[model samples]
Target: MDLSCSDQSDHPSRRRALAVATGLAAGALLPPAAATPSAAAPATGPAGAAAASYTNPVIWQDFADLDVIRVGDTYYASASTMHYSPGAPVLRSYDLVNWEIAGHSVPVLDFGAKYDLNGARGYVRGIWASSLAYRPSNRTFYWLGQIDFARTYIYTATAVEGPWNRLTTLSTPYYDAGLLVDTDDTLYVAYGNTTIHVAQLSPDGRTQVRTQQVFTTPSSVGTLEGSRFYKINGQYYIFLTRPANGQYILKSSSGPFGPYTMRQVLLDLPGPIPGGGVPHQGGLVRTQNGAWYYLAFVDAYPGGRVPALAPVSWTSDGWPVVQLVNGAWGTSYPSPAVPPPPRQVTPMTGVDTFDGTTLSPRWEWNHNPDNTKWSAGNGLTLRTATVTDDLYGARNTLTHRIQGPTSTATVQLDHSAMRDGDRAGLALLRDSSAWIGLKRDGGVTRVVMVSGLTMDGNWNTTGTGTDLASAPVSGSRIWLRANADIRPGGPRPGRFSYSTDGITFTRLGPDFSLGNDWRFFMGYRFALFNHATRALGGAVRVTRFELSTP
Candidate 1:
């Protein structure tokens, strides 16, 4: 790689004015001239028509605790998907700036029965931080992570779009683990928080052969986790995050198990979005042309944590430096590799008309959904999988990350099949959540808006949420919309609206203030749900799901 730092320009264009939104989610990095409104905060560097530059948080959707790797001319990223079935989403990119859904590493989150959400629950407790690695020697990709701090599970596939199969389940767990395959093809894992340890894996990359407690945090730095192990220039290094705050590096000239030295890579560097958290907790990669870059996530709550890309340069002292402008992390930087426009790429946020028999790979269930109860054809149909008054307890809710900074999602739903006590519509899914849907009760159908729903200590449904507004409706079909200002600050509210005809909508009820808690981690998402409080035979047909940003 062009490993030298002496010539790399950390200074971006002095004209770092935020441009208008690019175009929805995938167009986040495009120049404004070819763009429309987007959920992403605008690209902040030069807006020249031919300029090849991109803003930070290159992906405006939440793909938290991400790990990016490059193979040949292609780059792939796999991110955390707690409680979302079809969990580990694999994203592909030609140029590091723009990304699209390639497929998934985990087709179904089947770690336990609770994930089914039948009579149990698994919200905010499934897949957390994970490590994604490629083994060219074996022509395989391996995804490894611990579920709920239980046993560690490793999955392997020949391609990113996979028939990924479970390789093994280690009885022991490795939290926030980072995987490394040395030049000699030896496997290693660095894990733990507050204290760190390195483990060497057996030849097959399944069992732990040897382990060592390599380092301990000094308390002054508090804690460090989210590990990403790497070997460069004959030296062993481990990249870790102090979460929602900083990034650190541990260098071991010895081996993967180290007598290591430490250095701070970045700390509390302001994110591209104002009032957002720092860029940390992710991985690093080098473009085929040898440009090094760091792919980290910024905590942009309400919308969740999103990935940002920054150029990486090495110091004469042999440390990696994330380029900065005027002592702060810049909002935009030049595209690391100039490649042909994206191909066979599905936008992370866009319109899905449900024309095909199978749903797009971008859609994930709120949990391990009852696949037997849901189908997609003329429109996506979701049959009530469970009877529950609590939305969290309801099964078969399909969801996708919303666009960031700002975005809107609209869905056209045919609720004629909704039976008594059935609630079907669109929602902004989070811990403290809200929704606008058609509720059928006592032979009468009403359009209702519900808000202020919060989960309790055990994530059980504490309240059904407040009904902000309601009206008896005659139409069998209705349109629902959710407009969100997820940009960080105090109480950014996501509002709800509805329409009987598709032309206009009723913007009603008080604003549903977005949540600020980072512990929930997945952030807010736009979800389509239909559940019966009485029986399971009710269903809703979602004809269109259109996502837009402004």
Candidate 2:
């Protein structure tokens, strides 16, 4: 419905902050020591060890505007992309431990086509917190997507993976709508921060029955959004993300609209970490083991921007509380129940050496890229093609995974041999507009900057800079460090610095506050570009592309 500080203390501050949970776990204070770290399991235990289950966050990612649902035999979750390409990626998992990108909900949102905009690529677009519902009576699944600030539409199919049919577009626009199916088979649609509303949907999962009723959100968070329903023992629990605070749930004994009472802080900011913080979105997970847990996003500074999982235990009373060791959860938690002899695919650990062959999954382009433009063999060659427009507008560059905030990469450029129109460089990009890149033009490596790219295809820079030579370049391992800090009252600046030898470093003379523009762009990835009008002569070889956290 409506919208809305930080400190560096230590691990598990002595004090505790508690919100009420009525008729649920009432007045029960589960102190930090309740789930205290013990000698049984070391603070740093073998990741996913059995003992780790009792205390740790379960889901970690930038799954903003998160929505979780359980379909037949699987748990499906969809979140809004800050800057995700390829559309709204749906993650599927059998036990919530192992996750894989099953597919996208909408095949297209007309980024490059309808908009005629310069870089009209569909990496991540309008689709936000989409809700999935299965109408068992008709053997059908309903998917609702919100775009353009509350414009809502419904798509339905016989299966989750669709040959779907567009059902109807809602005249009422709600930002992030949550869908709930009542025990009587009545469908309730909830909007953000405003009066929580409900409506009955046609059995076919297409049309609506009548106008909706309004249930006011409790006056804790000014604008209440992200409202979902859960019927626990005849009580309707409305789980909502409380703007600035983490996820909280309210319970009522009556119908969808009721005089509900707030019960317990299911998940909140788990204190703070070195480069960033750990917090949860308003997402819940009920596992096959009859155990219920909460899934939220954790920012692990240069590492975890994606979603992470956390287990929640019910108190003797009906309330829920997140389990954390040393009073909080960390990244490596007990692995979820492995389905007897679980299929094991080792998680990718460190930097990938782009050794002339075999492109890694971590490597991705902004959009559908021409395969011929890049040569994986012969030392990662990227040829600059004709550029009628700046390469940033279109998807012609190459980028890799952002390991951490403070990481470094080195690419050998043979620009002296490069043709006139061709240009190649290493970029530290959050998006097209808020990025810093070093390119060799006219036989010199210059530092080019942009504050953020505009919809009209222009860049805003702090200053009119043409070169980076005045800055320090100490070694062969060129490094870019993104410092994450939180400030109160004022904007916390995310500082960017660079080093040539990977040892001695020099600040780029200014700090750039992390902007929302990158949310659409998402995580950091490096790219080699050749955007010259004429084809460049020599190929560019990117080597020692190692990322290290400073």
Best by TM-score: 1
Q: List the residue pairs that clash in candidate 1.
A: none
Cα lDDT, all candidates: 0.75, 0.46
Q: The CA-based lDDT of model 1 is what? A: 0.75
Candidate 1 similarity to native, TM-score: 0.90
Runs in model 1 lying further than 4 Å from the true structure: 1-50, 341-344
lDDT of 2 by residue, 263-351 (tens): 64634455324433445444655544445545555444322344555557666546667766566655555655433323332232344
Ten residues in sequence with the least summed lDDT for candidate 1? 1-10
RMSD of 2: 9.3
lDDT of 1 by residue, 8-90 (tens): 00012111111000000110011111111112222212222234568787888888777777766677777878789888788
Candidate 2 global CA lDDT score: 0.46
User: How many Å off is the CA of 311 in candidate 2?
Assistant: 2.3
